[model samples]
Target chain A: MSTIIPFGPQHPVLPEPLHLKITLKDEIVTDAIPMLGYVHRGLETLVSIKDLDQMVQVVERVCGICSCIHAHTYCMCVEGILGIEIPKRAEFLRIIWSELHRMHSHLLWLGLLADAFGMESLFMHCWRIRERVMDVMEATAGNRVIISINKVGGVRRDLSPDQLRWIAQVLDELERELDAIKPVLTNDYTVKKRTVGVGVLTKEQAYELGAVGPTLRGSGVAQDVRMTGYGAYKFIDFEPVVEKDGDSYARTMVRFRELYQAIDIVRQLIRKLPDGELSVKVKAAKPEGEIVCRSEQPRGELLYYVKGNGSKFLERVRIRTPTFANVPPLLAMLPGIEMADVPVVALSIDPCISCTER
Target chain B: MGFFTKLLETSRVKSPWIVHFDCGSCNGCDIEILACLTPIYDVERFGILNIGNPKHADILIVSGTVNHRNAKVLRNVYDQMPEPRAVIAIGACGTSGGIFREAYNVVGGVDKVIPVDVYVPGCPAKPEAIIDGVVLALGKLKEQRTAKDTDSLAAELHQAREFYANRADRQVVE
Candidate 1:
């Protein structure tokens, strides 16, 4: 007889509430089913009440870790409808801030992953490095997690020469600090034992199940939304980090390698910093079309679909967060593993339930 | 107070185990709560521990707006905590539902479901403010230790339930 267990809605391993009903037989899992809507606040319906400009703030709150990308995507959707091209400098600044957000978000995930595996000291060290990125965000954007710097036409905040110089210095310090902890995550005996060959999602399964971000790349797929050249990424030189193993270890390595990629992208953006106005004034013209915009978030691909009827309030606002797409892949990976390995495999997708539910 | 009671009170004040519940928060405030435990903030210096089990918890830290579904779970977790416990509602959503207040599913705030001892307000309450909120909740925990008794505890539960009932009625009227 198989024993059924409810994994969450309030489990310690999860930072957000995501319930998974796992069927187990003698410590081995038979299947896993996810139950969502715990963090749902009907944010999509708020588009009816909150105008386009105000929706930016609401969009940012959809998931705090990827707030910048959410706002950036929403703004991109609105800009697409309005048919306005943002300034080149604004594009570079947005990329800088977005990349910083990505770095901090991945660090947060890495620390959580460490804690899940009971590596307390490694968790602390990862968070310690993440705090540096948080400091830069707070100093530059005046808020740590949800910066709210993106506007429709361009960015609201501009970095001064001194601030830019300070950011570069911080980046240098971050690189040295990350190098110190990199080995423990990649080659440590305990880490490899817990993560290696666990929760493997084959490349074909990942593609069919619609896995995004590190989950897809970890399965040896070279798909990254950043490569689409939406914003300043077109000018930056980078590749999506991929690993063939498609296990928990591969997912961890994908995020770990992406940290350096984010830093490199930020460095390139700073070097190619163009001189221009921060924003073009958006007139009181109503957005009159439907547009879908996609951007890469720390978790994975973030898509925003906004519909407007020549009014201040959007008719419909639909968001497809990365975590939502990753759940099916998670369900696919859970069977045939011991119950103890559930947390390691579940967290491998960097499950952001709030983003998924919203 | 007897020796055992005095010892228990002292230990409770010295080391408070916190159980965090995320209601319907967008995750901004939830991360801030997590950040408090990190090295920079290092809330462990205050003898605070974040635990998963509610029964083992001395204080309940709730983030996000209390929505229709999570309000029941939030109350269940709050009820599971031992008596003389305190609740710290962090972030604007926890305190007053914040940006999602107008959203249909939101039940307004944490206080709508359970009594809150401290309210730390921010869009996503900063880590420093969350730490300060925990410190403030510790004081309330101490006060509850001194003031609470079996009869009064029962009375307070009734009052809390009645308070929620009345608020629900008022919301219906509005």
Candidate 2:
């Protein structure tokens, strides 16, 4: 006889309001089902009410952690529909901010992961470092969480040369701080004991379950939406980090490695920074097509589908957030595991319920 | 009241154990709440702990707009907290439903279900503002220092008696 238990929609460990139904006999899991829509804000349905210009702000709030990339994806989609190339400088600026968002998000996830695993000191240290990343974003984009920089044709804000230097200096300091924390994170006994060999998703399983981003990368799959070359990715070059073990530790390692890669990408974009217009004047003529756009968010690939009918209002706006795509694999990975490790396993994919529901 | 009860009241004010509940928030306000516990804002300096269980918590700090799915859960969590408790609504979304007010499923502000003690206004309610709101809840906890159980019970008894008296008056008029 299996006893089914409900785990969330509100739990202490993960910030997202995801509900997981775990079926268990004694203490071992039999199966798990996730019930989402707890935090669904219905932004996609608002496309009819909110015009194309005002929709950028709505899209950014889909998930605050990946807000920049959400706006970047929307801008890219809108830009695609309009068939106008954004200035090279704007693309560089977009990716610079996107990379900063990635670093901050990774550090945030690391801190939360530490907190979840009962490593309180490590959690505090990670958040302390994350503050510096938020500081850089706050100084440049005017807000720490949302950033609100991306627009349809270009971007809302531009960083000065002094701001660029400041960001590099701050990120370098963050890299050094990460250097200090890496050894303990990777080799710590408590972390490894809880994470190693836990929730293994093989490469084939990942693909079958539709896993994306670091979840797919952790399973030895080298597929990242960033490789598709959207935004400034067409200019900067970096390899998607991957680990073959496909367990919780491997996923953590993948994010940990990608944090450094994010810094490197920002540095490259800064070096290759171009001089051009901040934005192109957009025509009032409504776009008349359907377009699908994808960007690699901190969690994974965020896909946006926008349909237009030559009006200021869009026909439909749909978002396929990374966490939504990764939920299937989360279900596949939960069977026959110990009940104590449920939260850790659930968090491995970094479930963003609001993004998922929206 | 005995010395132990007084001591318990004092301790409750000294260290308010706050439980955070996210109804349908955008993760903005929820993260800001977590950020306050970090080294940057570090509300722990005031002896406040972010507890996991509601029964042990003296304050319920809720963020985000309430949708139909989470209204009962919010009330259930609010009910679990030991009284002489307070609720702080963080973010504009929680306070007034913000941008999600017109969403089909959302039930608007949290006040629609439970009484909110404090409302911290902002899109996400910055960590500084959230810290201020929590600190303010601490102040309320101290203000209601004497009413641990008996006073609230007495108030409820009075309301019940008043209901009967009003019914009797109505009968007389009929």
Candidate 3:
């Protein structure tokens, strides 16, 4: 005989409200089903009321952790519709800010993942390193989390030479700090015990279920949206980070390795910083076509579909967030695991419920 | 006040255990709330804990706008907490629904479902600002404690009167 249990809407383990109905035979889970829409605000429907220019701010709030990428992708979509080629310097600036956002976002996830398995000290240490990233964002872009730096044509703010130098110095410090925690996060006995071989989604399963970001990369799939030469990415040397193990530990390592990759990308972009206008003046231009743009968020792939009908207001705005894509793989990984391991395995995908529901 | 009451009041101010509920926020404010617990802000120094259980919580720290579905869940959480509790609504969404006020499913601010004692206003309120809001909520919690003590006494007297009146009616029937 099997028993059914409801896990969350409000659970201590979950940061956001995601209810999962689990069918358990004794201590082992047999089936799991996710119920969403708790945090749904119908953000896509707001395009009717908010104009194209104003939608930048609206889209930024879609997911706070990857807010920069949302606005970056949205602006790219609008720019595509308008056929506007932003300045070289503006593209590099977007890269720098978005990479910083990636670093901070990865660190935040690492901390939460540690917290999931009851490693309180590790959680604290991970967040402590993340504060420096937030400090750099505030110093350069003004706000901490939701920095509205991206406009349709280009970026809104320019980093001064002094600020760029200071960021380089801070990145050096952050690199050193991250190195200190590397051994504990990767090689520690307890961390490995909890995460290793916990939620194994093979390459085939990941591909079939549409897993994106680290979830797919962890399963030995060498797929990343950044592989497509978009924006300033064409000018830089980049590779998608991948691991052969299809388990929770591999996913953790994927994000941890991406932290270093983000730092390297930011440093390269800063050294090759071009001199040009920050943004081009668009003289009363209204987007007249449908355009779809995709970018790699901290979690995974973020796709934005924007439709304009020769008007200020966009006809339709649809966002496909990474967490939404990763949910199927999450449900697939849950069954056959012990009930106690549910939180660690569930969090392994780095489920951002707000992004999923939004 | 007795010695025990004084101790209770002092402990209430000394350590305010908080339960945070995300009512459809973009997570900017939620991260800021979590940042308060980290080393840099280290709100634990002030004896505050983000204990996720509502039953043990003395203060409810709510972030995000209340939506159609989660409004019931928010109210249920608030009801579970012991009396003489305080509620702090963080961010512009939690305060007045901010940019998403016009969204079809959004029910505006946290105050739409539960009584909010402190409102920390920001697109995503800073960790320092969230800490300040918690300090303010503690003050409100202390006042509520005193008010509850007096209110409980009046409730006890009314219960005694009702019991005696019921007994007198039974005697007349006999």
lDDT of 3 by residue, A1-358 (tens): 9999998988887889989999999999999999888999998999999888889999999999999999999999999999999999999999999999999999999999899899999999999999999999998888999999999899999999999999999999999999999999878998999999898999999999999999999999998888897889888887999998889999999999999999999999999999999998877777898988999998899999989989888899999999999999999999999999999999889989899999
Model 1 agreement with the true structure over A264-325: per-residue lDDT tens digits = 99999999999999988898859898988999999899898889999888899999999999
Worst 10 residues of 1 chain A by lDDT: A283-292
- Candidate 3: give the clashing pairs: none
| All candidates in order of lDDT, best leading | 3, 1, 2
Task: Enumerate residue pairs that collide in model 1.
Answer: none
Error of 1 at B106 (Å): 0.9
Best by TM-score: 3
- By DockQ, the better pick of 2 and 3 is 3
lDDT of 3 at A134: 98
Q: 1 or 2, which is superior by DockQ?
A: 1
Over 4 Å off, model 2: B1-5, B145-174
Considering only chain A, what is the TM-score of each predicted structure?
0.99, 0.98, 0.99
- Candidate 3's docking class is medium
| Order of models, best DockQ first | 3, 1, 2
Q: Which ten residues in a row have the lowest lDDT in candidate 2 chain A?
A: A9-18
Model 2 residue A263 lDDT score: 92
TM-score, predicted candidate 1 vs. hidden true structure: 0.95
What DockQ values do the models have? Answer: 0.64, 0.55, 0.79
